[model samples]
Target: MSHRALEVLIVTGPLGAGKTTAVNRLLKAEVAAGRRVAVLINEFGAVSVDGALVDAERPELAGVENLVNGCVCCSLRDDVVATLKAWCDQPEGQRPERVVLETTGLADPTDLVDLEQEPELAGRLRLAGLLTVVSCLGPVDHLRTRPLLRRQVALASLLHLSKGDVDPSAAVAWEGDLRSAFRHIPLVLTRNGVAPTDSPDPWRGDLRPVPEGWEATAGPSFAAARSFTTAWDHPVDPAALEALLLAPPAHGELLRAKGVCAFAGWAARNDGSDRWAFQLADGRLEISPLPLRADGSAPSCAAVVIGTELDAAHWKRALRALEVPPAGARRKVTVRP
Candidate 1:
């Protein structure tokens, strides 16, 4: 029998739209069905909290690869192509049967899949589907003001709605608006992680490009943005760190924040020891304790924050304030691969 290449699944959506939750559910179902899957999580910030969440939730899966510090549509396009190629080159049995890519909220869906159109990475891979998750409770008014949201919807092969528990009337109204706006796409309403269908057709085809003149009116210089990363060696106060993130800079154009934090006076595991992770989206925050390795080494902490025209110094100051021990007491911070 001839060996079949892995199927790639691309999951994307607006900020805080529940993409991670949907991916988690899909992965769990795949595992229960005995399918081998690998995940590539792309983020627009220096710190990557979403990747950590996936690792924590599905540690038993094949493996999770993170492409951080920039949007997949911009800085990491080359990296994405490289990573996918490397995954495909692995030994036949070792390669994953299915691959899932969870894109950053700010990413442009059309730009990401078009990498295949490039001379170098094309033909080696096929796009299985483009799944876009939409939040029923999100800022609909804000989306109306930004063309990117519409572009995201217009490009999706499958449109999944999260927060199915919201008010019936509100959900109906939101669904109606989405149906009208995305008349060509297939829509599915999910509640508590249950998707309406498990068929493959929901996410297959070439993604559609954004409508003309939409980019010009959305914002000035959308392509000029960049994301960078910084890592800390010293422990952090989980509560203080949460507070600092909650109170982001007034003028800062922060698009997203996600990562794990090492805390002082905290054990590395249960019965007095435990590590903590924070996942922030839109305005909601979820905290959970992670199991620690038996080694006595300190837990490394990192985060990825996305924005337009960001200043590293501004972030350094805010992060330093949240550091549990004085910055001078620890080794110099370094970004990860």
Candidate 2:
């Protein structure tokens, strides 16, 4: 008899769509059920915020790795393959039952799925599912302006809506829009942390491998973009940060923006202190104080923007507009696979 390798689940989404939150939910549920798991976070920028969040939530994971400083599709393909192989080689008694990968927002699902077709990794790893989280508030507008978001929605096997509770009545129209985009997949509305299911057995066999030739049409290649990270020892003014993203330069081919930062003055209504989450998309921005941490410690900010052309001068000028003093001198940014 032959031994079977561990099953792997992939969680992906566009920037600011809440893929990390969904993975955390699934990890907690799996842990509670006595299943050991491992997580691999492929971040587009130099800093790893999503990876940090996962470690903070599940400190006991069998393995938690971060592939930062580049997009997974172009630069980290071999790294992902090598990592999965290492996990599979672990002793059977210590090997995890499942593996989860949280891809960068701008990443196309097909890029990661294509790994299975590779001769080296195909037999070692099994595709459990392709779970994608879509922010209900952003998808409708993003699809109109961003080609990446549209491709993300079109390739999902399990579609989850983050912040869906904001407007319950919009479910009907949302469902219709999803159906028009992805008629064959399952779209589940999730709120807080609960998924809407009539029965307890929510896991179904709906996820399948990406069809051939899915990547050629999924927007721009991950190889053509770059990710940069900047840390600030000083807290930023929430209002000022909001204004910068709202009026980012129209020059170049920039496509996506996302990150979290520390605010010194702004405070939540419930608890009066300084902590916030920032997200930008399609000329719109959202700024809200984060409640869990109040003291305004050393906050890090990272951004991943895709452009057809690369201009360091334009990026420098844009970063200057943010007004927060750079913690360390700016370093040369490059992509490594």
Cα lDDT of model 1 by residue, 264-298, tens digit:
77756643435577666666666777644445332
Residues 50-165, model 2: lDDT tens digits = 66556545345778789987667777878988888888778876877788888887677767766666676667777777787777765465555666666667666678876767
CA RMSD of each candidate after superposition: 4.2, 5.4
lDDT of 1 at 215: 50
Clashes of 1: 10
Cα displacement (angstroms), candidate 2, residue 196, comes to 2.0
lDDT of each: 0.70, 0.65
Q: Name every residue pair that clashes in candidate 2.
A: 75-337
Model 2 alpha-carbon miss at residue 234, Å: 2.7
Candidate 1, residue 170: lDDT: 58
Lowest lDDT block of 10, candidate 2: 290-299
Off by over 4 Å in 2: 1-3, 117-122, 139-151, 167-171, 197-203, 212-215, 218-225, 252-255, 265-277, 281-337
